[model samples]
Target: MAMTSLPSLPLLPLLLFAIAANVALGATIVKTLPGFEGELPFTLETGYVSVDDSELFYYFIESQSNPKEDPIMLWYSGGPGCSAFNGLIFEIGPLAFNITDYEGGVPSLQYYPYSWSKSTSILFVDAPVGTGFSYSKTQAGWYTSDTKSAWQTYQFLRKWLIEHPQYLKLQLFIGVDSYSGISGSIVVQNIVEGNEAGVVPRLNLKGYILGCPRIDATINDNSKLIFSHRIGLVSDDIYEAAKKYCNGSYDDVTTSEPKCYEAIKVYDRLIKDINKYDTLEPKCTWASPNQEEDMSRRALEETSSDDFILSPPKIPDMWCHNFNYAMSYWWANDRSVQEALGVRLGIVDNWERCNKSLQYTLDVSSVLDYHKNLSKMGLQVLVYNGDHDLTIPCTGTQKWVKALNLTIVNDWRPWIVDGQIAGYTIKYSESGYRLTYASVLGAGHSPQEYKRRVCYEMFNRFIHYYPI
Candidate 1:
C-alpha cells in the first residue's frame, strides 16, 4: 500500500485544494492499539477522509481471507448520531472490548471470531461530522441532514477510493444497520447516478445489505403494536382496542381521537418498562440525570443505545447485555487510546458513543422510493432483521418489501445453522434485481450483537452468492 500520489484523473482541482488546506488526509497502518496485545493479527488502517470542512474518520480492515478478490463493504451504524464503533466493535468487526475483565482504566481488547471481515473487507466509518472522532472545521459543517449526510458519504467514498485505488476494482457494497437504512439507500442511489454521469474513479457498486432497517417512520412506528402483540407483550384485547381506535395511524397516539388516545395510553403503560430494542432484555436505568435527559430527547428512536446504562452496574449484581457499550465509552475517551488510533488532539473535547446534541435534521422521511428505483437497476440486496427487535420491527420491513411487488423467487422457509433453525427467510426478484429477506431468530435490534455467529454465517453465504 503506497501513500505516494493521486492518480492522474479529473480529481486534480479538488486534490490540489485538499493538499493546500492542510486537511487531515492520510492512512496510518496501526500495528498496535492501546488495549490489544503486541500487534494486530489483521491489517488495520485508520485515517480521515476530507469531505468539505468535515474530516470523517474510518477504520479499514482487510479480509482475513482473500483480500485482493473479496468484496469491500462500507458500514454505517444508526442513530443518525451513533458512532461507527456501533458496527465495528459491537456488531461485526474483529476487535472488541473485553467486557468481563474490565475493572478500571482502559478496557482490554479481544478478537471476535465471527467478524464479517473474515470474508470481506470493511470500512467502518464515523460519519456526518460529529460522530466518534469525526469533527467539522467550521460551525456550519456541524449542521447536517439526511440528504447532506448521504451526499457526504458518497464524497468520502470517492475521496477514499482515489487514495487507495487497489480496492477500486473490487465489488463495493454499502452495509448499514438501524437508522442508517435511510441514508444508505441514498448513498447507493448516488453512487449509481455518479457512475452513470461518468464520475472519476467510478465505484464498483454491486448492492447493499441492511439489518433491522428503519425505512419509513410511519410504518416502523405503527408496527410496534403488531410486534408487541405477536410477542405476547400486549394482550389481544388491548392490541385490538388500539388497532380499532387508532385506525391504522399510530405515530402520535396523543394527537389522535379521544378513544384512540386512551387506548394508546394504556398500551404505553403496559410496555413502558420493556426495552424497545429487545423485548426480552431488561431496561437498564441510566446512571446520571443528564444521561437520562439525553435519552428522553431521542423520541424518534434514532439511537441504537436505547438499553445502555451510563455507568455499568456490578457484574455480580446482575449481568447486563449493554455493559459493553459503557465499556466502550471509557475506552474511547482514554488519551492513550486516542493517540494509538491517531486521533487529532484539541479537535474534539469529548468522545461520546452517540452524541444526541448534534445539529441534525431528518429531512428524508421515507426512502422506499429509492429502493423502488434501485430495484430497477438490477442490483443484489439483502434486507434482514431480528425477530425480537421492536425498535425497527421485522414486520415493518416485511410490509415495505411486500409493497415492492417483486416476484417470489423462493417461498418462506427456515434457514439452518449447526443443524438448528436459526431463522426464516424468503427471496424476491424483479428484472435482474434480487432481494433476500431473513430474520435472526430471537435476536435483538442489531442482530449481530445478539447473534454474532449466525449473522457471520449468513453474511458469508450472501456475499459469495450462495443460498442462505
Candidate 2:
C-alpha cells in the first residue's frame, strides 16, 4: 500500500482544467437566456449606440431557473404608438383578464399557473421609441410613421443585442400583431440579411410568428369586397352602394365623408344582429362614464346631421366609446414613449377623432416598397386574419395577401386543430422560403383575447417545432 502511493500528479493542472470546464458549463447555462440582463420589473436601460444616434430603452425579466434552459421570445404590440406592456398584461403573460366582476370599478387579474414562460423567456419591447415605455428626448422624437422609423428601430434593437452579447447564440423569434406585422417583418429582414452579410452585429433569428397581421394596405381595401362577397353583398346594387357610399374610390377616406359615413351606416345595420344569439358582451363595451360621454357626443353629431339623418336609437346602445382620455393620459405620462416616437399632439383634433393624416401614415401602402425589398431578401412572410374581427376582418386581410402575389406553397384550406373551426390557412413559397396565412376562429382584431390557447399553440408549433 505504501509503495502504491509513491507518485503524486501535479495539482495545478487539475485545478486549471476544472476551472475551464466550470467556465464553459456556466456559459452554456447563461446562453439559454438571450437578453436577460438582470432582475424583473427593471427600469429602462437607455443608451446611444448606432450611427443614426438612435436610442434604446430596455428592461429585463428574470428567468425562472436557477439556471434556466428556456429560449427568449421578443414580444411587440401594434398601434405604431401603442405599448408592448398592454400585450404582456392582456395576452400570454402570467396575468390575464379576470372579468368576474363586470360591474366593478376596475378589472381584476388572474394568474396563469401555466404559461409560455414554462419553456420560454419573454421580452416585451416598446419599440420605435414612441411605443410603450421606450422614448427619446430629441426633437424628431419617437414618432415612427414611416420606413425610416423602422430603420431606426432596427438600429436600436441591433445595438441592444450587441450590448448584451449573451444573446448572440440564443434563438430569436419576432412576435407581434396588427401593425407590428410590418414592423416585425422589417426588423427580421434586417436581422437575417445583416447576419448573412456580416454587415451589422448579428442575431441568431429562427423565424417569426404573427397574429392577425395587417400586411397589405391595398388588400385590406379589397377586403371590403371579400366580405361583401362572403356575406351575400355581391349583388350589383351592393357593389354600387359600396363605391358610391363607402368612398371606395377616395384616395384618402379616413376623414368623414358622406359616402363613407353612409356606407358604414349600412354595414353596421347589416352586421348589428349577426351575432345577437351569441350572448357575448359587445367587444367594445365601455364603462358608465364613457357610455354617457359617447351618448352626448352622438346626440350632438346626430343633431348636426340634417342632410343625412342618423336614425333614432332602436335597442339600448352599447357604449363603445373611444379611449381618448386613456390614450392621451398614457402619452402625456410616458414622455419617453412620446419623445422617442414623435407622437404628435394637436396634429389631430382629438385622440378619438379619426385622423386622415394618421391613417395615411399607417397606410400599408407606405411600406409596400419595403415589403417588396424584404420578399427579395429570402424572408418568409406570414399574414394571419380573424374571420369575426370587425376591426380588421378576414376578408380585408385576404384582399391584402392576394396583392402580394407570392407563390402559394400550401393551398387555401381550413386549418382544423381541434374539432372546431380554427380558421383557414394559405401557404406561399418563394425563393426557397415559405409564407403562411392563418385565420383564427371567433376572434376580433386581437385574436389572442378570443383564442389564446389555440393561438399560442399555433405560434409554438410554427416557431419552436413543438405541438402545443
**Per-prediction TM-score to the true structure, in the order listed:** 0.91, 0.63
Deviating ranges (above 4 Å) for candidate 1 = 1-25, 286-313
- Quality of model 1 by C-alpha lDDT: 0.82
| Candidate 2 global CA lDDT score | 0.49
Task: Assess the local accuracy of residue 434 in candidate 2 as a C-alpha lDDT between 0 and 100.
Answer: 61
lDDT of 1 by residue, 370-464 (tens): 99889998788999999988788999999999988899999999999999999999999999999999999989988988998899999988999
Show how many residue pairs clash in every candidate, following the order shown.
0, 14
Best by TM-score: 1
Worst 10 residues of 1 by lDDT: 287-296
